[model samples]
Target: MGMKDKFQDQAGQRQQQANDKTGESREKAGQRSSQQRERSSQQRDRARQDIDDTRDEMEDRFNQDYDA
Candidate 1:
């Protein structure tokens, strides 16, 4: 092949390699973001449940005091 054709081929190959790396990085970033969201959701649910339980316990104590 001529020098121009060879140069063009090399440039194409480099572009393809760079594109592949970018795609992989994007996929990994998406996965990490998804996992973080799931973990935050779980923590929020647990906190809500804890607050509800505390409220119920306090109500029970107040009722007992009134009965006495």
Candidate 2:
């Protein structure tokens, strides 16, 4: 092949490699975002549970004082 043809072939190969890498990176980023969202959901659930527990405890304390 001529020199120009070889250079063109190499450029095409490089472009394909770059496209493949970009696709893989996008998939990885999506996975990480999903994981982060799951973590945030778990944290929110825990906070809600804590709030409920505190409210119940306060109600119990008030009842005890009222009874006494």
TM-score of each: 0.83, 0.93
At residue 14, give the lDDT of candidate 1: 100
TM-score (C-alpha, index-matched) for candidate 2: 0.93
lDDT digits (tens) for residues 7-37 of candidate 1: 9999999999999999999999999999999
- Cα RMSD for predicted model 1: 1.4
List runs of model 2 lying over 4 Å from the truth: none
Q: Which predicted model would earn the best TM-score?
A: 2
* Clash count for each candidate, listed in order shown: 0, 0
Error of 2 at 49 (Å): 0.4
User: How accurate locally, in lDDT, is each candidate?
Assistant: 1.00, 1.00
